[model samples]
Target: MHHARSLTALLLTVLTLLAASACASTTPGTGSVPAASEDGAFPVTMTHRFGTTTIEARPQRVVTVGFNDQDFALAVGVEPVGVREFLGYPAPDRPWAPEGVRGKQLPTVGSQDLDLEAIAKLEPDLILGINSYIDDEAYGLLSGIAPTVAQTADYPEGATPWDKQTEQTGQALGRSEQATKIIAETRAAFDAAIAEHPEFEGKRAVFLLGSSAAGFYNLGADDYRTGWLTELGFDVDAKGGEISYEKLDTLDRDVLLGEGIAEADFKRDLVQQLTVVKEGRYVGLGAFDDDFAAALGFNSPLSLPFLLDIAVPRLAAATDGDPATTPAPYLG
Candidate 1:
């Protein structure tokens, strides 16, 4: 009987040790261990406009403070502790955020009026500010909280191409290969759309936004949003200059893209006078769903796929240049 009791105690001890080992192996970023890369090497260094950030290990607690980095984070399988808040976004995640992170309770961060102290409290191991217009002072503070990455200086604000932004975000998270695949997939979709609509080639396109105060705003040629047009074989007609209400007629293009009727400064006389409008080459993007306009503004990978599927049909219709016909299939 005494010998049997000894064996039982020994078995109990082995089971306890096994449980402890399992808990110890839990991944910090996600509860489960991330899938293997080419070799499982880490401690990667990423360089940005601010400087270089060396991530000692895969970040367990990530925070994204920009328009699109959170989408990249989610796409690359890292759930961020916090994400930047966007205008008209009722929840922490944007409507177009990845399915895994949607409806999450992520804290909101970033913006000129950013709550720096709140971000600090999140205790993030990594902070991604790429695709954000983060100046030096903000960078200094965020770097103090953790290793931070910011947008490349080469691109203008809100203009980082989606592929560059995605690849950089992937590199930061040690998922470069995955990022490349995502880029290729998105590129394939764009290519397929172009293949389907050969008329989009050589078309002059412009995407414009407006507000009551700003009157009319157009993205520069450098803007990533403009890349959507270029990638689809359209020749973007961006002037890379400030377009005002007085210059409303200056939007010379075969295909005119705008957010809303009010934001596009579609004043009755102004609309009638514009050549694109008169030619029915105007695509009032808000006519489909105002959120499509917002997604274009955000310009993230998560939103890109959704935008591509819907925007292509509308664009193809407008490129026909029939004055009486609207992009009715999508407009309704």
Candidate 2:
């Protein structure tokens, strides 16, 4: 649900196009294979939205142009030379970055305002924009600088699932087997969490970001934040089509998650009309909390473990269907 408003707009525009075409089968394209070395690595080709980019050998100098691409790279044992700077927040550090990268001085690439000159100066052998908005022009430029990998062409812009990004990233870096293991372990963690919280099974849930002016906004099915809930065995209810402000009261589900809702807005008559709110099944993720926002934006292997710790118990308490019980405190 990172940038939920912008993400929803992109999804609506591409939903019909995606439905018409069978892009689900459009896995990342693979090009020519490199001669395997004793390590069983190299010359790998990674297919993405832009086109097939071949990495002749294992890349030593890497740069990540996407918001969380650095996290993905670090999780797989590579330290990027440069990473995209997170806007709005004062600092650029990610809470879930591995210990090795926590204090390292990684140069910054602009997200909203890209610094092509800075990226060029880094002289990276591999450029990862896998989870970012890399247009044809940017791709051409970045590819010229180094082999560039953009988001999956099949999925809508900015909507590439995190797991797909992670897998593709690993492939590009000649670490497919390691990436697969990381993904399996993350999935196993989710499975274990589900096994522990039997109450979350088949429970209807909705994730929302609320404000006084916009009311409550649903992170639609396409958003990874909601998708993660579905992974944890919750039946997530996503807004299929545009639900106007007036019709917000009609949103029905058992477990309601509200992010960034002010206490005053919670007291509003219209907001209180929702069934979940009336039943005291709403879990409030604090507006000022940085960790919650970071989890929504960066659902990577390193971050998912932290997210599971917070999300499972709150979801369990919310869906228990008991008005007398309240969820544990939002630890994040």
Each prediction's TM-score versus the true structure: 0.81, 0.83
Candidate 1, 1-332: lDDT as tens digits: 01233333344443454445445543344521255542353788887787888888876778888866777777666677777766545434456766666666677764445555556555677888886666776676667667898887777776778889888888888778888888888788887998899998888787776545445667657667677778888886555555766677777788888765573347656666888877777776774236676567666666777788778887877887566666643342
Q: lDDT per residue, candidate 2, 132-245, as tens digits?
A: 676675676667667888887677777777678778878887767767888888888898998888888787777777565656667777776677888877776554344445
> Which residue window of length 10 is worst by lDDT in model 1?
1-10
Worst 10 residues of 2 by lDDT: 29-38
Q: Using lDDT as the measure, which candidate wins?
A: 2
Top of the candidates by TM-score = 2
Task: Provide the overall lDDT of each model, using Cα atoms, as 2-decimal numbers.
Answer: 0.69, 0.70
Candidate 1 segments exceeding 4 Å error:
1-39, 91-95, 211-215, 242-246, 263-267, 287-289, 329-332
